[model samples]
Target chain A: MKKLDNTLIIGIGNNTRQDDGLGWCFLDALVKNGFNEEKLLYKYQLMVEDTDLIAKYKTVFFVDANKTALNEGFLIEKLTPSKKVSFSTHAVPPNQILNLCETIYHKKPTAYLIKIEGYEWDFKIELSKKASENLKNAIKAFIKEF
Target chain B: MNPRKIIIEPVTRVEGHGKVTIKLDENGKVSDAYLHIVEFRGFEKFIQGHPYWEAPVLVQRLCGICPVSHHLAAAKAIDQLVGIDPENLSPTATKLRRLLHYGQVFQSHALHFFYLASPDLLFGINAPAEKRNIVAVASENMELAKKGILMRKFGQEIIKALAGKKIHGILAVPGGVHKTFTKEERAYFLDGIKIPNIDTMIDWSKEIIDFMKNYHLENAQWIDNFAAYPSNHLSLVDKETGALELYNGRLRSVDFEGNELLNIEDIEYRYHFKEAVKPWSYLKFPYMTKYGSANGWNRVGPLARLNTCKYITTPLAEIERRIFKSTTQNKPNNMTMHTHWARLIEMLHCAELMKELLLDNELMATTDLVRKGTPRTKGIGIIEAPRGTLIHEYHTDDKGLITKCNLIVSTTHNNEAMNRGVRVVANEILSEKPEITEPMLNQIEIAIRAYDPCLSCATHALGEMPLIVQLKDYQGNLIDEKIR
Candidate 1:
């Protein structure tokens, strides 16, 4: 296992969609724990598919809630692109994003995904109890990994 | 004589989903023409129960292309509802907002001129499908195309810096923006001002102006009579005092004859304005009932803003206006075909405003992000969105939970105008040609698309929408139909 000095952690989820904000919550926790700004790259939404950034970074951590698969708590797993995830609202998907980085820059960053199980995907601000707990666990695990 | 059918499906390279239909009679004459919007996502309905503070974030999701405009309007609305004074917001915060807006103007106008509308100019309307794109234009005019790309990128970078992300920024809150512009950020912004390639942009704009002068002058007759109606025009005016108020001011209503009706405040909006839903489209039409019979289903946005304002404040835009007026009747409504021209003028104005706001020393003094006051029982925020006039009306409980919310987007104002424009084109083109073809229909669609209606913003959201198109003959028979 390689421990990187500099890391870019991105939280990808809709904050209004309850558990979709899991990625952002993890990012908030890291900031609260006195994580230095230089070691983190916290983002709420993946608006543009800037492939260059992905290729340049050493380690990339993406935190989002998995709505399709129900895991009620934090599920820490290393995610590789299986085809392209069309679940994103953007033009480029996660798989294509990785592929673009590799093909264009000949570099692949070590990537891990932290998915918290979400119960509510509807338009709401407050998170479910299970999702909130999952988020807390995910943050702990993420800190441990760092 | 056998009639040929022309199909230009998916109208590629545009921002949103839309289609064009044209029918010609046997004698190669146009029989019917229409511009049809295929997708409809109701954003208004989704926002009904959301908190007032969250309105900015929710509405920003309306359009990926111009999310900043929605964000600005929503922020303005919140400010209005809460009656937060401009002085309360740090002048720096306001300046940052203005800068972001100018950045929006730069990128959006560039997208329209370079990618969407340029094809019609660079390649003639009759250009082959493969040859009519920015990529094709880049192959020949690489430097020119690169300038547009750079300009757009610069604008996006400004937004990305001020707000955490580009598309939907959380920085813009109810009272004011959450963050302030640091010295480093200001230096980075000033560094952007040093780019020498901006000269290329000026030259490109001049070329576009020349094209508008020549080609658009000839085609102006088509848009002249289409959707010509009288209505009041409303926008944010500085009012001698430099205070910013989008929701509290009097709504300026300008007539077809360029006369001011009454500049009533937001509370009086119901007395003068009422929204009517048409069966043809999901967009709601806001009409001035005070004008006796609602004859004026007027437009909002670029063209409407230009028409409403007495004089543009910016020097560069004023110069452009002089040149624009030299070619026209000097009346704002006369140059309907010059909506593209109006967009560029507003872009200049927004830029000038941004520069002035950034230089204001008072902007750095404000520290209060949210006003320390009770939430209003009821409030309305009205601002001129990039598309046009946007209104966010809300009713909140004592606990700050939202009870009801109503958003009347800019696209809704143009709803009636679009329908009227389409009917005019359809009546003229369809009646002349007997055979219906795709190219002929596309021209009519182009007319409607010139408005750039964001129906998603207008309607709010329910679910993913499938495309739908319906054609009716003179005898009222269903001639052609497609729904997916």
Candidate 2:
């Protein structure tokens, strides 16, 4: 398989939900902290399921807050698996999107899952302090990898 | 005799989700009528803590129908707060902005006039829901309906050329517009004009006036006693000449008799106007008083503007003033139906204004588009949106990050008026009938819809469940519960 060239940093969450916006928050911090806009590619909300957008990138970094069965402020790291997680309402899952890319373009991009632990997803304005702190830490870690 | 309950659910062919409910009392009297909004997108809350620069783009998303109006108002507000004289923008850029705005006003009004309200006026109220649409009207009056569509397309094209995107163009910024109109763009805009159609539209408007004169005479009676409130009318007046300004002007509020309320300098808005949240809806009602709930039925848009302006500037607008004046009863306030006439007059004004700006030689001068500034200050931007007065107030930190943002959209200003109008129509229709038919209720709904209330822009209440109205007799027995 041909290796991917560009890195896609996908931030996924409903912005209306306060702490659920951690993934976007971390991405925004990265953008603010002198991250080159050219190298960093693709930002999406809720789900990165746009077919056209998914097909172009070689590497996909899915950044989202994991609310179910995860420690608060913990990072869950994983590589793209053959079997994709099933979620209703999404156009296509992450693995399926990658597979489609490979089938069509004769190349598959490396994928990384960076899920931040979130405490509250209630309808509120301000972010929880713990989630906010975890977001800063996640950004720091992501930058180290860069 | 049992009075029938009529429910117009998910009022179609409009911008937002709203419903009209008419309730009949035991005496068969129309006890209550309501034009209620179901869904609420909290734009005010969403915009908080973002950059002040994103105000235009974010606020524009509030309504797909009137994105240009929101864009212009947001840009004007930021320009005021940044203390940049947007009048310094090349006249061509200013004209382009005006042209785009005119397009928004024309298309939006045309949508209301042709698609929404004209169905009831042209066809009887009892017409089938499926047939009561612009398509039905177009089938009978194809050329006339096509004219409106053509006019709307012209406006959209102008917006697309200037703003890059016709709907939510981010061209208007703090100092001035980002894009300039090339000679080719200007020629292309002028190329599509149907010159003969202008005469046709003028004739069609005259026919509309005649129709309203014959049939809507009683409709005009409801607003006969309407009194022009002497409160301040706020608008963006040109800073240089103090003439009626559209795009880049300082916020000025004048009374009905033409008295200045306040200059509303960028920093002084917090002192003049305060935003109050209502428990009934998510939309924040803005009041002129420094403290307390928003009181009194203050108005915005064309009616308030006409009352405030000393005289109409454009020739077509001046001619159209007769249509506004022709319907007046004892005083100026009686002709609420004149809002329709007033809207057309403004459309003419907007078009003429665009032409004037384009012809000016000074418009071609390109100086500074973006002023280099690092000063962070909280400021308010106010402009006369097409529907009414729109205010966008922002509190920003020293880094220009938005701490809090409040938008008093056009529909919010007309909320009280719309409710009052609904009540008046209900009272008039319900008093005479022992049994109300679905058609009668539809007429009442049409009366309220004539205002063209932007429910999306208005305050959002909790989601509307199926309305259940129960009527009880004096004996405490369950009389009836109408479920719709």
Candidate 3:
């Protein structure tokens, strides 16, 4: 068992929405692999108050289901603060959250966004076959690096 | 030449998907305008056949922003199905429910003001689209943004503590609540160790109201006149004292001149009100049947509540209410943008009410959490949600299954009012202008945002629904289009 101390991982998406549950599945894989449960946070979407949670940690990872095509099953890229104005509060993008964290609390944590390629997004709990494969690969990649 | 129509789809910064349609006659004069709610979730229709008790939990699928409101409203109705009236509920249960309701109101007001309305107030309507959002507000005024966030967080914490989660948590069950407030849970808000104390919430609430006052002073012309119109006002007031009451009270309505229109028992709303549907929107127009469709529509929410109430029960809020009333010379304030001002005053009121409940010792009572009475087949629950009066009615069968359900949410009550506002703003801003800029389109959104309508509770997929303004002629051909 490895201790990922001083780190926070947020899985953002709804489990009920088929492949959108990829983020939660990734975190679930980490838990099964003996990762600490306290370090992981689950959310349906990002909100303004999330800045407070991310500000306390030294490093943060945001796991979400991606709609766009990807070279690999998953990709992990560093996230920087973005000033992109969101039209609605329905979905606050990860970059804007980072920006809010820096602007509001003045704490800049090292952040990475792990976007898993999701093929299906309908009203079902189980992931699609391809999405499941991507989740597994994403979990393996996440574990290999961390 | 054919008449022209301009559409602004999915207006920004509000909760859900909505659009504004402004029609121009052949002469380029504004003929009509409407704020259409495009997203549809047949929640009331689908809620049928579930166990009557499940209404509270299932109805929470309404909106993430104000699920607690729906949860409680349904619970109040379910209590009737279980044969318990509101008065018969235990003191502890009533207190717990009131606290949760106040928390919902407080957080919702804070969110609306800070995230949605403040951008327009802070940067003015003429500011660039990018500069009129939460990120820009935070960048420019860090302290105000921080306070807004924390004030909202405090109310959410209260909801989380009582309901189990902030968004979809459940506290009330059939006759009463399932749990009581604990001393440990209470201290988290009172001790000022982990989060800002309730007193801090009170102070911040007052500060924001003051900020609104100053903003109003500086921008009185627009703040006072923009989309301003005379309309009826509706809310729930204390049955006995006629003071501002959110949790449980008589349904009160007043005309624009402060004349009492209707004050009825909450359960008798069906007799007085009717919902009329429009061809353009899924949202229904709710109005007093007596006043007919045209004039019966009453504006609900902070401004309406202030107008209909005799006074506020809380000391601090009563004082602020007096000042708010004085601005309009004790008349029903018809200034639409003053909704922000009224909403801030309500944030202060909710904070004060939460503090009063947090200190009361009865809140810790573990006994009498649930109550049961003579069972009934029909129940109606009405509460003043942060936005306005919310009604939930249920009809049950022998097996206690919901046979039918109807909801007249706050936003539905304000549908006609919002359409009127859009017409007002569009006529003023876009009637004769040859070129419509993004900021000009924003003025229409500014009017609708004042009501803070929760347009849809639909799914928020990982994409932005950009504001699309399309100019189309009477033949339905796109003449011009703009996107932001």
Query: Highest lDDT among the candidates is held by which one?
Result: 3
TM-score list, all predictions = 0.71, 0.66, 0.96
Better structure of 1 and 2 per TM-score: 1
Spell out the clash pairs found in candidate 2.
Answer: A13-A46, B77-B381, B91-B363, B92-B363, B301-B388
Candidate 2 lDDT, B78-105, residue by residue in tens: 7655765445544555665676776677
Q: Give the top-scoring candidate (TM-score).
A: 3
Q: Write the per-residue lDDT of candidate 1 for residues A50-89, one digit (tens) a residue.
A: 4456665877777777876655476767656433322222
Runs of candidate 2 exceeding 4 Å displacement = A1-146, B1-8, B20-26, B30-33, B85-92, B124-128, B193-278, B290-295, B329-331, B361-367, B372-374, B459-484
lDDT of 1 by residue, B273-377 (tens): 777764544556678777643564667777777766656766766777677666546655643446777776665565556556556555455465455344566
| Candidate 1 chain B, run of 10 with poorest lDDT | B241-250
- Scanning candidate 2 chain B in windows of ten residues, the lowest lDDT window is B460-469
Regions of candidate 1 where Cα sits further than 4 Å from its true position? A1-146, B1-50, B80-90, B193-234, B240-250, B292-294, B366-370, B373-375, B461-484
Candidates in descending lDDT order: 3, 1, 2
Candidate 3 stretches greater than 4 Å from native: A1-4, A69-72, A120-122, A128-133, B457-464
Alpha-carbon deviation at A135 in model 3, angstroms: 3.5
Let me know the DockQ for model 1: 0.08
lDDT per model vs. reference:
0.61, 0.59, 0.90
